[model samples]
Target chain A: MKQACSIPARAGIGLKPSHYRDALDSVGTIAWFEVHAENYMGAGGAPHVWLERLRSNFPFSLHGVGLSLGGAEALDQEHLANLRTLIDRYEPGLVSEHLAWCRRDGLFFNDLLPLPLNEESLDVVARHVEQTQEALGRRILVENPSSYFAFESSTLEEPEFLSELCERSGCGLLLDINNVYVSACNNDFDAETYLGKIKAEQVGEIHLAGHAVEHLEDGETLRIDDHGSHVCDAVWGLFEKFAGRCTGVPVLVEWDTNVPSLSVMLEEASKADRILTQVSSH
Target chain B: MQNGDGDTLGKIVGDDSKFSRRFSVYRNNVYHSLTVALSDAYPVVKRLVGDDFFLAMARTYLDGGGFPVHAPLYDFGKDFPDFITGFAPAESLPWLGDVGRIERAWLQAYHGADAESGGMNLEALSSGDAERISGLRLVFHPSLCIEQLSWGAFEVWEARGGEGVAGMKVEARKNFIVAARGMDGDVRVGSFGEGVFDFFERLHNGKGIMAAAGDMDVSVVGEVLGGLVRLGAVIGVEE
Candidate 1:
C-alpha cells in the first residue's frame, strides 16, 4: 500500500482517543494525525478501528515511544517486529522513534529514558537504526529526546551525535522542537545554537508540544516534555526559527494528557498552521 | 560475570552491592510503570479491590511472574485472572477470578473493532418464524465476549463499595454473561439462559440459526432472540 500521509507544509494534531470520533467527524483540511505506535499494537480494538477510519480521510504518522533504540545491549528484535507489523498494516506517511533507551537485560521501562552520546552508544544506535530501516524497507526518522541530565561519560554534543547517525545510517531526523527547548533549559544551553547545528536536510518532520517545569537542586530547573497543554511562547518562537529553514516539513502538535475537546485541539493545530503559513509565505 | 557470551541473571544484575542496588531501582521502575499501565487498563478491577490491595496483589504478581515478552501495555493482563486463581490471598475470594473474566471481557469489548455480526437477520426472517428460530446458529459480533461463571460474577463485578457479603449468597448461581459493542460505539452487558447459550455456541460454530437453536423452548428463546436483534448484536442470518 502507498504511504497514507505526507507532510504538505501544513499542521496536524496528535491523535488522542478522546477526540477520535470528533476527529473523524471533522478531518477535512486538518493536514494529518500522528499517533503513538505502541497504543495501536493490538490484534483489533478501538484504537485500530478508529485509526482505520481516520486513515481513510487523513494520512497518519506513527511516532513510536518504545523500541529502546539506543540501549547498551543489542536492540529488541520483538519490538522491531511489532513496528514492522504496524507499518505494514497502516502504511503510515511517516515513521519515527526517539533516540533513547528504555530497556536493559530484556526488561522494559516503557519510558523514553535518555542515552549518553558516546562512540560505543552511537555505534549501537546506528546498527539498530540500519536494521530497523531495512526491516521496514523505508526511511525512518530518529527524534531527539527530552533529557533531564547529561552523562559525564559522553563526549559529543546531542546535535553532532544525531547528525552523525543520519549520515551513517542514511535515516531522517524528526526535529522535536519542544524536546530541544526542554533539554536546553534543563542543561543551560542556547536552543537556537543547538538548532543551528543540526543538518536541516536530514529532518523529515518536526514536533511541537507543551512541557511542565520541575525544580531541582542548586536552583536548576528541568522542563519535562509533558505534552499535556497549550504550546508555550518560547517553544513556539524556537519552532518559528526552525520552520523558516525546514519550510515544507509536516509539523505535529503532540498532546498526550489532559486532552481538551476536538475544537480545542483544532485550535492548537490552527496555531501551528498559522506559523507554518507565515514562514512559507516569507 | 560472563561477557561476550550466554550469561545468567546474576551476570546481568552483577555481584557488586551498588550494582545490585541500582538494578533494584531499575527493576522497581519497570514494575511500577507496568502496574500503573495495568491499573489504567483495568480501572474497574482496581476499584473492585481497593488501591492498596490491588497494588499489593500486583506486587505479588510481579514477584511471581513478569509480563509477556514485548507485549503492549494494553495486552499486559491476559493471564491476570489465571494468576488470581493461584494467588494464596486471593484464593478465599472465589469470585475474584470471575470478576477478572468480566474485566478481561470488558477490555476486549472496549478495544475490539466494529464488525458486522453474521448471525440471524431479524428483518429477513418471517415474523412468524422468529419464535420458532430456536437452535438457530447464533453468531455474535467479533467484540462480544461470553463467560460462564460458577457464582454471582456479574453482580460482584458490577457491585460497588464495601458491601458486606460473606460466602455463598442468594446470587451464587451459575450465570451466562455476554458483553458486546454496538454500531454506535456503545458497549453493553447482558445475560442468557441455557437455550440461548446453546444457540450461541452453535452459531459461533458456524451453524445457521435454524440449525443451532433448533431444539430449545420456542417462546422463551424467541424473547432472547428479539432482544439480541433489538440490541443489534446479530448482523445477518443465513437461510
Candidate 2:
C-alpha cells in the first residue's frame, strides 16, 4: 500500500482554527492541509469536527512538533501512543516529525531542539523511530530541523546522518528546505552543498517557512527559524532550487505564530503553487 | 534506566560539572515553557491575576510538580486550579481556581471539534407527537461541559479584570454553568438550574420526552426544550 499521507505537489497551508470556517466555507482548490498533531489529540470537539470536514475535501499531513524523537533518553511511550491514536483516527496522508529532540530525561523544552550526532544517540533514535513507525503501522517522514548550536560531540554530517536514519528506519523524508538554509547559514555551511548530499527518492514532502536574523553575543548572526512571518526572499530562492531539483513532492507553507488571516495565507500558498508549477512544467 | 525519568533529565543537560548550574538552565527553560503553556491555556486566570503574580505562581507550581509526560503541555495544567489554592502567595486568592477552570474550559472550547449538526425535524412530528418531544431523552455533545463554582465565577470571568476577584467568596458552594460551543463558533456559558439539570439528566438517560417532562410543569418543559434546541445542545428528538 502507498504511504499513509499523500500531500500533492501543489502548495498547502498549515491548518489553523481561526481559518477553520473559512476553509470549510471556501476550500478553493488548495491541494492539501497540515495540522500540528499535538493540536488535535483530544477525543472530540471543534478541531476534530473541522478536521473531519476539511479532510473530506482535502488531503492532510499530520506534522508533529513534539515527540522529541531524537532525545537522548527512551522515547516517551505515552506521546507515541497519543500520536498513534491520531494516526489511527485521521489516517493522515503524510505524517512527519522533526529530526530533533526537545526533551531530555523528563524535562521537555517544547521546541525543535538540536541533537548530538553520535553512535549511542543514533542507536537510541533509530530504535525509537523503528518502534514509533511500527506502532503507527506506517513509515514516517523525519524533517531536518533548524538549530542555533551544534554539539562538539558530533560525528556525522546532518545529511549523512539523515541518510543513515532512512537506511536504518526505512522511513521517508519531509525535507524542510528553510531548515537547511537556516542551519547552513548558522553553522557556516553551503546550503546547496548540504542539499546536494541527500537522497531525493526518500524525500516525500517539503516545508517552506520564514526565518529571522538574530544577533548573538558574538559578532556573528544566527538565523532563527521562526515561522512567524512570510517566506523570506532567500528561503524562497532555496525552495525554488529544491523544487526544481525534486518535482512532484508536496510543499507545505507553515506559519505557526502570529498567524495571518486566511486570505493572506492563501495568497502565500498561491505564490508557492506558481513556483511549484514552474518547476514541474520545466 | 531504572529511573528513566531522572536519568533522562540528567542526560539532557550533559554536564556533570556545575550540574546544578547547567541543570538549572534546562530546568528553568522547561519550567518556563510549561508554565507559559499553562498561562496560555488559561489566559483568563493570568488576566485575573496580574502578570507578575501569575508568573510567580506558575514558577511555584512548577517547582512543586513536573509534567506527567512528554506530551504537549496542554494536559500539564489540567489540575492547576487545585494546585493554585495551595500556593502560599495565592492564599487570599480564592476564586483563582474558578478562574483557572474557566481558562482551562476556554482552551478546551477553543480547540474543541465542531460537530456535525443533527436534530430530528420538529416539523415532521404530529401535533400530538410534538408534545411528546419534550419528554424525549437528549444527547449532549462530547465537548459539553458543566462546571459549578461559587462566588460569581462566570461574572468574574466575563469582567476580565486584574483586581483578582477582590470581593468574590471562595466558598465550596456550587455554581451551575453550562459550557458548549455554538454553531456559529461562539463558545458560551450560561446558568443551569436544577430544573435544567434534572431535565438533562432525564433526557441523557434515554427517557422519552413525555416521561422526562412528566414531573416538570408543562410550560417549564416547553421553555427548557426550546432553550436547549436553540443552544444546539439537543441535536435529535425521538417520540
Candidate 3:
C-alpha cells in the first residue's frame, strides 16, 4: 500500500478481521480498505500479519479515532510517532482523524466525542491538525463527527468550522454523509443542508454508514451512530444527492459493530458502487 | 463536561435547554464503547458474571474512576484484574482473581512485540561453564509471561463456554501458567510444575543463575530448561 496504490473513485468496505479471508478470496473488488489507527498500535500480532497480507492487494485509508484532535491539551507525541511509523510503512492513499475529543486530562474515552465549535476550541483543533500534518509529512483528512449534544458556546456551524480548519491547517475534509444525517436528525436540522454547505473540492473522501435509532422515554427518537446495520434508505438517498457534489471522492461503507456476514457488507459496497456509477457522469 | 452527559453538555456548549434531551445518546455511546472494550478484554470475566451483571460492573468500573490513561484503549484495563480482587459481588468466588490474572497475562503476551529471540540458548551451559554462567543473565522472549495461580484456572478458561469452572478444586490445583508468543504469532499458554515456574520467576526477577539454580530441584531443571528451549520461550544468554 503506497501513494501509487490507487483507490478507484469507487466504494469500499471496511476490512474487518472477520472478513479478511473472504476479502482475500475476492481481490480487486474494493476500492480500498480503511482501519482505525489505534487498533493497529499494538507492537505485533495477528492484526498486523493479516493487514500485511491484505496491503499488497488493496490501498488503505488509516482512519484515526483516538487522536483527541479537539482536546484542550497538546497533541500526544507518542501517538503521533506511532502514527508516523504507520504512515511511513503503509503509505496509505489517505489518512484521517475526527472533529472530536476523546481524551481529557490523560483519560481516554476511546470513542468519538463532540467539541464546542467555538473560537478557542477551533484554535485548539487547528493547531493539533497542523501538528499532525507536520508530524506525518502528508495532507491528512479531518472527519465530521456525529453529535448528540450542542453547546451554547459553539459559534460556528460544523461545516464552517471544518472549512476554516482546512484553510488554516492545509488539511482535507472527509465528509461523512451518515454523520450529517444522524446529526441533523438528532439536532433538528436538515441533512441536505449540512451536505450542501460542503464544497466538493475540499472533500477528499466520503463515509457512509448505518446508525441505530433509540427511542427515548419522552416519546422522542434519537439516532445513534452505531454503525451496526444496513445503511437506511434515508441515508442512502442523502448519499445519492451528496455524491454529485464530490465527483471522484472515494466512498466507504463502515459497519463496525454487530458486523454481519462479509457478503452483506459487499452488498452494501455494491449498492454504493451502483450509486457512484449512476452519478459519476454527472 | 465533567459528568459527560447532556446537562453538562448544555452548561458548557448550549445556551438553550432543548438539546438536553439528546444527552443520553452520547452518554450511552461513551459507556457502551468503554464497556465493549472491557468486555472484549475480559470475556471470561463477563461470562463468569452474566451480561447484565457484567455491563453494570463495567459501568461501575468507569463511574468509579477507572479511565484509560493512554490514547489507544488497548491497554485500558491494565489494573482491572487487580481491581477485581476487592470487588464485593465477586468476593464469594475465590478463584476469580487467579483466572483474571491468567487471562491478563495471556492478553499481554498476545499483544507484545515480535521476537525471534529464541536460539540454542542453554547449549553452552551443558558443558559445565559454572563461573561464566553465574555472571551471565538470560534474555527471556519478549512475549514470555509466567503466572502462578491459586488453582488451575486454565481448566475453567478452556471450559468457559461449556460447564464453566463450577466446583473446580482449588486445593489440588498448584497451577503455574506461562504465556508466550509462538513463531507463527499466536499466543500459546502452558502450565508447568512448581520447579520450572520458580526457575523462570527467579530469572524474571533478575536473579543470578547460581541463585536461581540453587532453589531448583535437581531432576526437573534439565527437563524444564529443555522444554522452554523447545517452546522458543527462552532468548539468548545475556551477559
Candidate 4:
C-alpha cells in the first residue's frame, strides 16, 4: 500500500514541510517531488505519514545531503542501509545526491564542501558513487556542488571532472544551473564553457534556484547559493541554455530558506515548466 | 559566512584579492542553516533564552565538536541537555537544560516508530485467574518516553501561552513526564504519578508484572492498569 507513482520529465519542486499539506492535496502541473533523504531517516513519524499519502499522489526522489558520498573514507554502511530502507519503502522514481562531501573521518560539517578536482579525489568519489549505485541497485544523478572557493590542488576543470566521474561510475549528472553560474562568477570561469564541456547525454536532471549577491566588507561581490529568493535572470538564462542540451531531464526548483507559501513554490515550478515545455516543443 | 584569514579558500579563487571576503558567503551559509536547524530542534530553549542568545548558544553547541556523525538534524540535539548543564552562561537558569531534555523527548516521540496500538486481547486477558494478573508483563506503546525531572519544566511548557513565565518561581519536585504519540498521529505530553510512572517504567524496561510493581500501592494497581489500557498505552501483556 505504501509506494510511489512514476514521474515525467517535467518540472518538480523540492519537498519542504511547510508545503507538504498542499503537495498532498495536489499541484497538478508538478510532475514529481524530491526531498533530502537525511530528513526522512527517522525510524518513524509525521514526515513518513504525510509522505506516504503524498507518495501515492506524486512520485518522489530521495536526494541526500548527509550521506557524505564523496567522503574520503569508505562509504558509510549504516547510512547506506538506511537509504536502502527508504528506496525499498518509497520506490522513488529517481535517487540523487550531491557531488560534494560534508563529512570525513567520523566528523560532519553540515554543509556541502567542495572536493579537489584531481586524480586522487576523483577516484575516491567515483568508488563511493559506484558503491552507492551498486548498494541501491539504482542509478543516481549526482548534482554539481556550488562552491565559494576552490581547492588549490585541483587540476581538472569542474565539467571535465564531472564528465570523467560519469564515464567511470555510470552515474548521471544533476546539473544545477545556479551552481554553474555562481561558481563561474566566484571563481572567475566561463559558465558557458563549463556547460559545454559536460557530456550532455549524461545529464539526467537540472536544478534552478535563487541566489543572493552578498557584498562583503571589502568592495567586492560574492554569489551565495542561498535559495531564499526567486531564480535570477542570469541562472534562468543558463538553465535555458542547458535545457536546450539535456532536452528532457526533469528540472527541480529548490527553495530551502525563506520558503514562501506553496503557491509561491508552485509558481517557480510553473516557470521551470514553461522553459521545459519550450525546449520539448523546439 | 564566518570570515577568517585562512589562505586555503583564497587559493581556490586564485586571482581574487578579496578571497576571505568572497569566501564569507559559504561560511555564512553553513553557519546560518545549521544554526536554524539547532533552533528548530530546541524551540523551547529558544523561547526561554530568546533569539540572539539561543542562536549564539546553538553556535557554541555546534563548536563543541561532537555533533553526531551522519545523523539528520531531526535526531540532532540529543546531547544538548548535557551541553547546556555545562554551559556557564546558562548556569543562572539551571532548569533550562532540563527543559531541553523534555523538548528532545517530545521530538523523539513525535518521530518515533509507528505501530498499531493494540488493545489487550480481552479474551486472553479475562480468562486468567485474579492471581495471574499480578504476574503479567506489559508492553508500552513504541513511542512512549517517560523522563524524570527535578524541575517544573512541564509547568513552564503548559503555561506557554497563558501568560509569560519570565519571573515565575518553579518548584523542584520529582516529576515523571510522559511523551506519547497516539494512533491519531499527534504527540502530546502529560504527567504521571510517581508510583504509576515507576510501574510503567519498570514494565517498559522488560520487567514482569510482580517485579515491576514493587512498592506501588496494591490497592491502586488495578486503577493504574485500567487507566493505562483505556489510554491505549499498553500494547501487549504476557499473563
Candidate 5:
C-alpha cells in the first residue's frame, strides 16, 4: 500500500495526459497534482498506468465532476462505488465534488447545472453530501460552482448556502476564487463581500481558472467558466488578496480546455506559489 | 429544470430577455461539453464526416433524447456507432458507421481491464499431451475485441494516422479487424483474414483448440494460434 500523504499548502496543476511526461520529470517543481476523478474511473488503461507512475512522485487529489451531489434525486450508487474503488487504489490526499447538479431523473447533462439556494434544496444537498461522505468513508470538500444566472426562488445568498452546507454536512469548502469572481460579476454582487462570508477555516483548498467573456447584444457582459486560458488579471488579484487568509490551503491551477504546454502550466502554478509564499511569510 | 419541465425554474432566473439569454448559457454548456465528449470518443468518424456534419449529427443525436444516462462521460456514447448507422444524413457514407464502430472498439479495448501478468505458456503447450492440449480452453485478454464489419472500416481507421481519406475509396468489402491492448499498454488495431478471425472468435467464445479449429486446415490453425500467442492475446489455458 502507498503511504498516506497530505496535500501541502502549495500550488499544483490539474494533471492532463498531454503533460504526463513533463509532469513526471518535474515532480518537485510543482507542489502536487489534481485530476478529474471520472477520467480515471476506467477499469484499466493508460490513465491508470500514468496516474500510478505519477502518484509515486507527487501527492495527488481526486476532484470529481459528476457526483451531482446537489441533485433532487437519489445519488447514483454505482458512481459512488466506482469513486470508492478509485480512492482505495490511488489514495489521493484530497477528494472533492461540485456544489451543483449535473443529472436529473436519470439523464446526466454533463455540465454543472446551477441549483436553487432555498431551504428545501439545501436539505437535499446536505443529505447527499452526508451520504457521500458516509459511503466513501472520507470527508470531501464541496466546490462553489460558477453560474451564469441566479434562481429567483433562492432564499439565501451563495455564501450563506455554502456555509449552511458545511455546517449541516460537516464537509469542507473548496473556495474557487475564479468562480467567485465570475459569479459576482454575473449576479451583480461584490466578490470580496462574498469571500468575507465564507468561513476560512472550513476552506480546505482553493481553485484558480480562466473564464471567457462574452458581450451580449443588449450591452450585457457574461463570463463563462471555460477554464481554457491563463488566469486573468482580476482573478489573480482576488487570489492574491484571499491567499493571506487561507495561509496553507492547497491551491490548484485548472485548465481543462485548450490546454497549453507543461511549462506554461508550471508557470501558472509558480504564480500561485509566489503569492502563497509571500502571504505565509508575513 | 434539467428535464425542461416548464418555465417555473426559468422564471426564477428572470423574466427579462437578458435573463433568458443567461439561462441559455447552461443549455449551451451542456450541449458543448457532451458534444466534445462524443467527438473525443469518435475522432475517426468526426475526421471522416468533417466537423460541420459531425456537429449536426451529434446535435440531432442529443436532441432525440440520446443523452448519457450516467456520469463519467468516458462510458457515454457507447451507442453512437449504432446511432450513426440509422442516421439519415450519414446514409451517403455507409462506411462511416463501421469506422465509428472500429474507433469505439479501439477505445473500449484501450480502457478495458489489464491483461493477466503472464503470456501464453509455450512450454505448457509443447509439454502437455496432445489430447489435453486439444481440449484446453484459451483465456484471451480482456482488451481483445474482434469486429467482423461489413465495410472496410479498418482501412479508414488506419488512414486517420496516415494520408487521411482525401483521395481514398471506401469499398463495401467484409473487413475482419482486431483491437487489443498490447503488452506495451498501447491499443493496436489490425486487420486479419477470415480464417484467423473466426478461429479467435471461437476461442473467445470458450471453445477449445480442437473445437475452435473446426474444419479448418491444421496448419492454418497452428499459424493463427502462433499469431495470437505473439500478440499476447492468449493469457492462459483452462481445462
Candidate 6:
C-alpha cells in the first residue's frame, strides 16, 4: 500500500559525512536531509552515530543506490533486510530507489545502468518493485535514471515506462529534474515535453543536482549527471518549472563528488527554496 | 546487455557512431566509480603507489573481474589485500599488501558494531579470589582487530597524513597493530611491542588472563589490560 509522504514541502540537502557538524548545528535552518541507503549499511560506527543524532533533530529520506531494482535476477534479500532495519531505526519521512539496475549475474557494476523501455523489461521491473514494496512493508519512490544511450529494442518512452510501472506496482515517482534535463540533452529529447508526460500526483519528491557537460569527439555535447558541482542554471530552470506545477513536493539538493563546503550546499538549497517560494506565491 | 557479449549489446544500442561513443560513457562511469571506491578504501596504498600507478593497478584489478559480488561497497574490497600480495607490478614493494591489510582493518573497525557497556568489570578484578580472577576470560569489542605483519605497515599508515611515504625508510620487521573503536567512538590504531602483542593475541584466541600471560611479567599484563580498557577493546570479563 502507498504511504503518505511526511517530509515538509521545502528544500533539503543530501547529508554527507563532511557536513555532519554543520547539519547538526543548522537543524532548524534546513528543511530535511537525504542519505544514500547503502552508505550506512554498516553495523555501527561514526556513520550511524551521526545519523542517529541528526535523525533526532531533523527528518531524513533514505535514497537507495544498490537495490538493483530493475535487474533480471532475483532481489537481494539480505540487502533488503538491512534496508528494512535502517528504516525501522531511522524512521525516515521518505524512502526511494532508482529505476535502474546495478547488478547482474551476482556482480555489482557500481553504476546505475540503463534499462530498455519495453514490455518484457517493464514486467521485470514491476515485479521487482512490487517485491521491494512487499518486503519493506511500505511504498517507495522509483527515480528515473540519466541515460547516455537509448535501447533500440525499446517499444515505449521513459515517462510511459515509469508511469506504467507506478500504475502496476502502486509505487510513486521521485522526479530527478536534473536527470530529465541530462537525458534530454544527451538523447536529443524535449525536456519540457518529458516533464509534461509525468503524473505530478505520483511524484513524492524532487531531486536537484549538478551535471558535467562533455563535448564528444563528434562535436556532440553529452550531459553527464556527476553531481560534482553546483546545480546548473538549466537544471534550476527545469526544477522551477516542475516545482511550480508540483507545488509542496519536497526538494533535495545532492552533491556527491568533489563535495564543497556545507555553506555552498545550503546556498544551493536556499536557491531552490527561493524558486519554490516564488512559484507558490504566484 | 547482461552478459559480456559486446557485439549483441552494441546491436541493441543501435549502429549509430554516436550511440557507440555514448555507450562508452556508461563503461567509463562504472570504471571511474569503482576505482574511486577502491581509492577511498586504500588511501595510503593509493598514495604509496602514486596516482598514475594506483589508477593502472585499479584498472588491472577491475579488468581481472574484481567487481564486488555484493551490493554494499564497504564490503567490496576485502580481498584487495590478497590481490596485492600476488600482484606482479607491486612486487618491488613487498610491504604493500600488509599496508592494505592494515587499512582494511581500520575501515572494518570504523564501521564495526558498537561495544556493550560495562567493560572489564574492574570490581571483579579488585575483589575476586586471586586464582579465579587470574582464570577470567576477557571479551573483546566487536570492532577490535589485531594485525601481525612482517613489515612496518602501521608506520606507512601513520605517515598517510604527514609528508607521506616520500623519502621515508620502511623497516622490515615484525609489526603488531591494534585497531579498535575507542570510548569516544573514533577508530584508534596503535603499534605495540611483542609483550603487548602476545597478550592481545592470546586473548583474541580465547585464552584467559593467566593462560594468555604465560610466563610474561605481571606488570606488563596489567599495562596491556589498562590499554585495552582505555581503547574500549575489552567489553566484558567472564570466569
Model 1 stretches astray by more than 4 angstroms:
A1-5, A72-85, A103-107, A216-220, A280-282, B1-33, B49-68, B82-97, B113-135, B156-171, B182-186, B192-203, B206-239
**Model 1 chain A, poorest ten-residue lDDT window?**
A1-10
* Clash pairs, model 4 backbone: B1-B27, B1-B28
B113-221 per-residue lDDT for model 2 (tens digits): 5566654554432245654555455665545666656545666776665465567554555655666666566676665555467666676678877777666787777
Error of 5 at A92 (Å): 1.0
* CAPRI tier of model 5: medium
Instruction: Put down candidate 1 lDDT per residue, B8-42, tens digits, no spaces.
Output: 22232123543344334335546667788777765
lDDT of 5 at A49: 94
lDDT of 3 by residue, A117-221 (tens): 978888899999999988998888999999876677789998899999999998889988899988898778888888889878888889999999988876878
TM-score of each: 0.79, 0.78, 0.90, 0.91, 0.94, 0.94
- Over the full model, what C-alpha lDDT does candidate 5 score relative to the true structure? 0.86
* Reference-based lDDT, residue A87, model 2: 83
Q: Write model 6 residue lDDT over A5-52, tens digit each, in one string.
A: 779999999989999998888867878999999998998889988999
Winner by DockQ: 5
Tens digit of per-residue lDDT, candidate 5, span B125-154: 656476777887887778887777778767
lDDT of 4 by residue, A84-107 (tens): 999999888888898887765576
Q: How displaced is residue B55 in candidate 6, in Å?
A: 0.9
**What's model 6's lDDT at B158?**
86
lDDT measured at residue A117 in model 3 versus the true structure, 0 to 100: 92
Q: Which stretches of model 3 miss by more than 4 angstroms? A: A1-5, B1-20, B117-139, B172-175, B193-195, B202-212, B226-232, B235-239
Query: Which of 1 and 4 is the better model by DockQ?
Result: 4
lDDT of each: 0.74, 0.73, 0.79, 0.78, 0.86, 0.86
Q: Chain A TM-score for each candidate, in the given order? A: 0.95, 0.95, 0.97, 0.96, 0.97, 0.98
| Tens-digit per-residue lDDT, A14-106, candidate 1 | 988888888877958577889889888765656777888888899889988888788777767777888899888988889999898776666
